[model samples]
Target: MTSLTLTRGATDTRTARATGRRTAWVPTLVLILGALYCLVPIAWVVIAATKSRSELFSTFTFAPGSGLLDNLHDLSTYRDGIYWQWMANSAFYAGLGALLSATVSAAGGYALGRFAFRGREFVFKLMLAGVLVPGIVLAVPQYLLMSELDLADSYWSMLLPSILSPYGVYLMRVYASAAVPAELLEAARMDGAGEFRIFTRIAVPMMMPGLITVFLFQFVGIWNNFLLPYVMLADDTKFPLTLGLYTLLAQGASQPALYTLVIMGCLLAVLPLIGLFLVIQRFWSLDLLSGSIKS
Candidate 1:
C-alpha cells in the first residue's frame, strides 16, 4: 500500500508540471500578439520613409524603396532647413522643462513624503487634483494668463507651464516614501543636518531612478506635445517638431513632393528618443533594481 501511494503522488506531480507549462504559453502568445500590434505602425513608418514620391504610391506598402538618401536631402533642404530649427526648439523645451520639472518634483515629493506640516495633506491633495485636470481645459485660461503677463507667443509661455507637473510630484512622493528610510533621516537630523541638506545629500541620490523616470516622462510629453505649444506660440519659427511636422503635413497635401520630406522628418524625430532609451536603459535598470532591493 505504501509503494502504491508513493507512485500515485509522483504521477500527480508530473501532471501538475505539465499543466503549468501549457498554461504559460497562453500569456506568452498574447504578449507576442500585443507586441506585433504596437510595432506594425512603427514598421510602416520606417518603410514609408524610404520611398520616393513616385514610388511611395506605386510600390507595395512593405516593400523597400531606393530614395532614402534623396528623401533625407530634400527634408534637410526644405524651407531653408527650418526643420532643423524646429528640432532644436523641441530639444530645448524638453531638456529644460524636464530638468526643471524633475527638480520641482524631487523637492516637493521629498517634503510631502518625509516632513509633516500643517497643510501637508491639503497641499498633496491639491496637487493630486491638478493631475485630474485636463490640459485642454486649461489651455485657453493659460493662454489668457500668459497674455496678461505679456509673455504670450514666447518661449516663456511654453517653459513656465511645463515646469510644474503634478504627476511627477506624485511619482516622486511614492518613490521617496519607499526608497528613503525614516531611520536614516532621523539620524541625519540628529547629526545637525538641515532638511534641505538631508534631502540633497541622502534622499536625491537614493531616489535617482524615480527622478530619472520622472524626467524621461516629462521630456517625452513636452517633446511630443502639440496643443500647448500650438496655443502658446503664434510664430512658426518657435514651433517644436510636432507643430513643425503638422505644418509640413498640411503643406504636403497641396505639394505632394513635400510628403517625402515629412516622412524623413518623422524618421529623424524618432531616432533621438530611441537613442535616449538605449543609452539610459543600463543606468535606469541598475538604479531601479538597487532601489527596489533597498526598499
Candidate 2:
C-alpha cells in the first residue's frame, strides 16, 4: 500500500509538469504566428524594393534584383530632391508637435489629476470627448477654421492643430494620478514652493516615463498624419513624407518606373520611427501602459 501511494504521487507531479509546459507553449505559439503575419509584409517590401521596374511584376514574388541603389538615386533626383525636403518637413512637424504636445499633456493632466479645483472632472471629461471626435470629420472643420485665421496651407496649419491631442492628455492624467503621491505635493506646498515649480520639479520627474509615453504617441501620430497635411498644404515643398510617398505611388500607377522609388521611399520613411523605438524602448516605462504602475 505504501509503495502504491508513492507511485501515484510521482505520477501526479509529472502530470502537473507536463500541463505547465503545454500552457507555456500556447503563448509562444501565438507570438510566433503573430510575428510571422507582420514580418511577411515587411520582408516582401524589402525584397520588392530591391527589384527593377520590369522585375516588380514579372519576377518571382521573393526574387531579388540589383537596382536598389539606382532606384534610390532616381528618387533622390526626382524634382530636384523634393522628397528629401518633404522628409525634413515631416521631421520638424513631428518633432516639434510631439515635444509641445507632451509638455501640454504633462501640465494639463497633472493639474487635473492633482488639484481639487471645481469642474476639474467635468473639464477632463469634456476634453476626453475630443478623442471620439472622428479625425476625418474634424479635419474639414479644422481646415476651414485655419483658413478663417489665414493660417491654412502653411506650417502653422499642420503644427498648431496637431499639438492638442486628447488621448495624450488622457494618458498623462492617468499616469499622473497613479504615479504622483499627494503627500509629495503637500510637502512642496509646505516649503512654500510655487505650484508650477513643484509641478515642474517634483511632479515632472516622477511623471517622466508617462511624458515619454505621451511624446511617443504624439510623435508617431504626427509623423504618420496625412489628411491634415493633405488638406492644409498644397505645395509639394511643404508635404510630409507620407504625402510625398503617396504622390509618388499615385504617379507610379501611371509610370511603373516610379514604383521602385515609392517602395524605396517607403522603406526610408519608416527608418526614423523604427530607430526611435529601438533606442527609447529600454528607457520607456511600459508598466505605465496598463496604468497604475505600483509605487
Candidate 3:
C-alpha cells in the first residue's frame, strides 16, 4: 500500500510538470509569432532597399542586393533632392508641433488635474469626447477651417492642427493626478510661490515622464500623419515625408526605377524614429527609476 501511494504521487508530479511546460509554450509561441509578423515587413523593406531596379523584381524577397548606394544617389538627385526637403518639413512639423503640443498639454492637464473651478469636469469630459472622435473625421473640417483662415497649403496648416492634441491633454491629466502630490502644491503655496512658478518648477519636473510620453506620441503621429497633410498642402515642396513617399509610389507605377528609390526612402525614414526611441528610452527609464527611488 505505501509503495503504491508513493508511485501515484510521483506520477502526478510528473504530469503537473509536463502540463506547466505545455502552458508556458503557448504564450511563448504566440510572442514569437507576433514578433515575426512585425519583423517580416521591416526585413523585406531593408532587403528590397538594397536591390537595384532590376534586382528588386528578380531577387528573392529575403535576399539582399548591392544597389543601396546607387538607390541613395538616385533618391538624392531625384527632383533636385526634394526628398530631403520632405524630410526637413516632416522634422519641422513633428519637432515643433510636438513641443508646442506637449507644452499646451502639460498646462491644460495640470489645470484640469489640480484645480477646481466651474464646469471643470464638463470641460474634461468634452475633451475626452474629442479623443474618441477620430482625427480622420476632423481632417476635412480642419482643412476647410484652414482655408477660411487663409492658412491652407501653409506650414501653419499642419502645425496648428497638431498643437492641440486632446489625447495628450488626457494622458497628462491622468499622469498628473497620480504623479503630482497635493501636499507639494500646498507647500509651494505656503512658500508664496505663484501659480506659474509652481507649475513650471514643481509640477513640470514631477510630470516629466508623462510629458516625454506625450511628446513621443505627438512626434510620431505628426511624422506619420498622412490624411491631414494630404488635405492641407498642395505644394509638393511643403509636403511631409508621408505624402512625398506616396508621390514617389504613385510615380513608381510608371517609372519602375522610382520603386527602388521609394523602398530606400522608406528604409531611411524609419531610421529617425528608431533613433529617437532608443535615445528617449534611456531618459524615460531614468526618470521612472528616479521617481521610484524618490518615492
Q: Which digits, one per residue and each the tens of the lDDT, describe model 1 over residues 1-295?
A: 9999999999999999999998999999999999999898888889999999999977667988889999988888888899999999999999999999999999999899988899999999999999999989999999999999999999999999999999999999999998899999999999999888999999999989898999999999999999999899979999999999999899878989988888888889998899878877888989978867867
lDDT of 3 by residue, 1-295 (tens): 9999999999999999999988998899999999999999999999888888888887576777889899999999999999999999999999999999999999999999999999999999999999999999999999999999999999999999999999999999998999999999999999999999999999999999999999999999999999999999999999999999999999988988889989999999999999999999999999999999999
Using lDDT, give the best candidate's number.
3
The candidate with the higher lDDT, 1 or 2, is 1
lDDT to native, each model: 0.92, 0.89, 0.95
Ranking by lDDT: 3, 1, 2
Each candidate's number of clashing pairs is 0, 0, 0
- Stretches of candidate 3 off by over 4 Å are 1-18
Residue 289 error, candidate 3, Å? 0.8
Clashes of 2: 0
Query: After superposing candidate 2, which stretches have Cα over 4 Å from the reference?
Result: 1-13, 285-295
Every model's TM-score? 0.95, 0.91, 0.94
Pairs clashing in candidate 1?
A: none
